[model samples]
Target: MRIKLTYESLDGDIILPKHYNYHIQALIYKTFTPDLATKLHNVGFPLGKRRFKLFTFSRILEKGIPTKDNEKLIFKRKITIYFSSPIEDIVGNLAERSFKEREFKLCNKKIYISQLEIVTTPKIENKVIIKALSPITIYSTLYKKDGEKIVHYYKPIDKEFSKLIEKNAKKKYHLLYGKDAEQMSLEIKPLKFSVQENLKIIKFKDTIIEGYTGIYELLGDPELIYLTYETGLGNKNSAGFGMWEIWRGKESDEDA
Candidate 1:
């Protein structure tokens, strides 16, 4: 399930740090009951030895001007965000709590829920085009001979990019359904992308992340495609990377 949330600032403008993923993440956790919040935070849904949070959210959708030497973003009154999860409890808890509370603090700025609605699921086919709402990231952590840890971020065209994403999605399927899916192949191919324009660098708390934003064609089983829609694509989903929506090519322009 998915939900869209629109927030309006009670103050004249909403000001926030340039890298505010942590703040938004914190706000989402706060919307849950204390016990639920603690469990989701400390111990997520377990599948084998690994635990999955099973939730992902898009980056804030708003126009804002950077100020104070690019340290902060100042937005006029309102912002919108999309959150998704296959787990009904996670999605339901967020919507119910936000509606009941109505008001909350984001980056210490007073704000109220101006709008909240469940987003209808689109018909996901075995093959479809998608555009990233947040950058999709795939990486490997390697330790050097000198005992130095290095994060190697991959471009969408890299072989490991598709391999890792397909692997990740299968794991999600197994975790969600508690059974293995039938053997099938999944492929993600970039459609519209530019290295200079689409490369994104983000800082979440103290960690620097490299990711990419663009349109891509996903070819796979329909079930896996739908799972990707709800749980997001690639890696670091809970930290606000890899949320995407379907793009209907020329139809999108016509609709706009």
Candidate 2:
């Protein structure tokens, strides 16, 4: 399920950390019941050695602009966010709390949910166009010559990018349905891409992550494609990465 959440500040301006993904994630956890929150935080659904939180959210969207320095983002009035998950329980918890508790603390600023709506799910097919609402990220953990840990982020065009995404999707499928998705096939083709321009650098607390945003063509099994839509593509999805929406071929195509 996917939902659109719009928040309006009670105060004049809404202030947030420039890198606010961690705050957004914290807010999401706060919405859940304590038991649910603890479960998701301490122990999510397990598949082998890895755990899947199974939820993803889009970047905060706001029309008003304010000053931006090195540490904070201040916006006037309203902001919109998109949240999605294939698990009905997870979506239910978020929607229920968000609606019941109209007011929320985004960082230290206070805001209220002005509107909450369930976004209609688009039909998935073997071939579809998508645009990232949040940057997509995939990476490999490695050790340096000195035995220090490092992360190597992959570009969209890198062979590992699509391969890892497909592999990750299957793992999600297994966790969701308790069935192996080895038969599912998926491929990602970049339709609009530029490394210098599309690359996004984000900070989650002290850790830095790199991701990309662009239009892409997805060719795959319909089920797996939908899974990517709900659970997000690539890694660090729960940290507000890899949320996407189907792209209409033209502006007027919405009614078609």
Candidate 3:
């Protein structure tokens, strides 16, 4: 489910750092029941053996007038948070806690949540073009001559990245449904992909990781299609990566 969280800046303007996904995750955890929060965070489930996040987010930035302290950033007072998971409690608990607080902290800045509204109309299809609200991050390790390992981050558009998306999708499916990961039948083909130069970099933990946000047309199982959209398509979805929606073509229903 997608939620529009309207926040008023407690202090003049709200300025967030690049790769602000960590901060948003923090807000949800603060409002969660201690036990539930621990489960999602630790993720002892099977898919989590490799540590996959089950949620993604839309950018939480609003253009604002620049202030002297931070001339580079505009004052932003609003943001939208998106949550997609098979577990009802994960979604329900966060929604309840957010409503209760009504006002809370984000990125060390205090803000009041004036409004919370659902913004999702789910449509599922076997083959659909999905648009990313958050960047899709794919990671692979590069082996050097000396047998050292180097991790490389990739956008979904890369030729070899489809396997990464497919593997992650199956992992998530198995993790949630308790299906055999090796036997699951799933296909994800990248029909089309668009890339932006610098907007996809994410700050994960301490490192600056780059990713891409755009439209991708992928063909797969109907259940997988919806799950891909819900659980997010790529890495760090729980930290705001690979969140998507079904792409309705330019023609409206009336036009169609």
Candidate 4:
């Protein structure tokens, strides 16, 4: 894990431990989004590149002979921002400096407010994937609690219901795990079955209510099941929303 330290203002200056490496500093900056990205770019900081050096390590044996082979130690470049005040203040001052075409005063020196560092590892981008599963007709009932306020209840079609009702009942199912397949095949199951339920409601001082409730169910083979769920809620502050999620199963004991 990477750690970041930001001070509001400098009553006194601060120093970093000599042992800390540049790569660690870079990792800290990577945790934030556009703020750091834009700043680094504006300062002409190099991107998608890194620098490092190699050192050799050796082990000595009891017989005074070198036993273990020499190993290489590598270092890379990273960037760290040091400020006399809190992070918020540092960001503000940096912005002000940028707008005024002036440099920020730090550590008793005028600096550009950004630093370049060397790290041991390369940076990676984050990826997200979204998939759709089978759809089912939702049987819902609405009740009014007050003016312009309503609650909805949904349940699965009874097994003994008419064929038409059964055919229309929403087909609920879980997502199954697969490896790199472009298309997925889903097996629908009963929507009423769920392994867990989570519910929360928040009421603001202005009497605006907002909440969320969700249910999860597992499907597929025991060794590679998919989990699925539906969630939604709303109040005076905003209209409620509902969504579904499905994902592959955790590794089995055999894999562990």
Tens-place lDDT per residue, model 3, 1-256, is 5555667766766776545677777877787888877876887354444865466666553544545764234555665556666655667776778788777877667888777776675777666776666777788879999999888986555666787888888888877787766654445444344455434666777867777765567776777767777778777777777777666665311101
lDDT of 1 by residue, 1-256 (tens): 9999999987799998888888889999998888889998899877777777889998888867899699999889998899999999899999999999999999888899989989989998899999888889989889999999999999998999999899889999988887786595578999888767788888998899988888889999999988989998978888888888888676442211
- Indicate whether candidate 3 or candidate 4 has the larger lDDT: 3
What tens-digit string does per-residue lDDT give for candidate 2 at 85-189? Answer: 999899999899988988888777788988999999999999999988889999988999999998899999999999998998999988888887999988888
Error of 3 at 201 (Å): 1.8
Stretches of candidate 1 off by over 4 Å are 250-256
Lowest lDDT block of 10, candidate 2: 247-256
- Candidate 3 has an lDDT of 0.67
Better candidate by lDDT, 1 or 3: 1
lDDT of 4 by residue, 108-205 (tens): 32333232222121122121111112112223235566646454423222332222222221111111122422232223334333222222322223
Q: How far out, in Å, is residue 191 in model 3?
A: 6.7
lDDT of 2 at 154: 93
Better model by lDDT: candidate 1 vs candidate 4: 1
TM-score of each: 0.94, 0.94, 0.82, 0.19
Candidate 1 residue-pair clash tally? 0
